[model samples]
Target: MPNVTIYTTMMCPYCFRAKKLLTQKGVKFDEIDVGTDPGLRREMTTRSNGGQTVPQIFIGKRHVGGCDELFALEARGELDAALQAA
Candidate 1:
């Protein structure tokens, strides 16, 4: 499995949903709480190419976007492959 990193805020439902999906898939992810840190938020924005939202997810080095995009990948049957990628 590849390294999964998710930038999340404490109270975001989308973030919780995204994490639940990943957990269901048996994927261990690095969760970064950016709720109180402006620097971390800035880092997330820079990494995501200006995505200023909760649950900015990355599988390995590839950006998988937010909760909706993550579910879209699952619906498309590409999420497993992405997770398994090197």
Candidate 2:
């Protein structure tokens, strides 16, 4: 399984939706609550290439952007392959 991580705020609806989608897809992830951790938030920003938004997602160290980007990947039939690849 890929090492998935998601940086999120407690009250972000997109964050919730992103997590829900990942769960529904049976994708296990490490969730970091950046709203409560400034250091992690800073790290997430760096990881996301300066995307200072909630729900910065990664799959095995590959920056995957946020909710809309995730959905876009799914729409393009790329998400599954990405998840399954080494």
Candidate 3:
């Protein structure tokens, strides 16, 4: 399994949905709560290339954007390939 990291915040429905999808895919991820951490939030934003959203997800070292983008990948049948890619 590849390394999965998700920068999220509490009370964000999109974050919950993103995590749910990952869970359903049997993927373990490192969740970083940026609810109260300014520095971490900045980090997430920088990592996401100006994406200041609640759920900035990274599969290994690849930035996968937010919930909609993630589901889009799944819909296109590209999410599994991304998850399994080296």
Please identify which of the two predictions, 1 or 3, would achieve the higher TM-score against the true structure.
1
For each candidate, the alpha-carbon lDDT, in order, equals 0.97, 0.91, 0.94
Model 1 regions more than 4 Å off: none
Model 2 residue 72 CA deviation in Å:
0.3
Best by TM-score: 1
TM-score of each: 0.99, 0.95, 0.97
RMSD values for the candidates in order, in angstroms, are 0.4, 0.8, 0.6
lDDT of 2 by residue, 3-47 (tens): 899999999999999999899999999999989878988999988
Instruction: Give candidate 2's error at residue 6 in angstroms.
Output: 0.4
Worst 10 residues of 2 by lDDT: 36-45
Q: For model 3, what is the error of residue 85's alpha carbon versus the real structure, in angstroms, after optimal superposition?
A: 0.6
- Model 1, residue 66: C-alpha shift (Å): 0.5
| TM-score ranking, high to low | 1, 3, 2
- What lDDT does candidate 1 reach at residue 27? 96
Candidate 1 least-lDDT 10 residues? 77-86
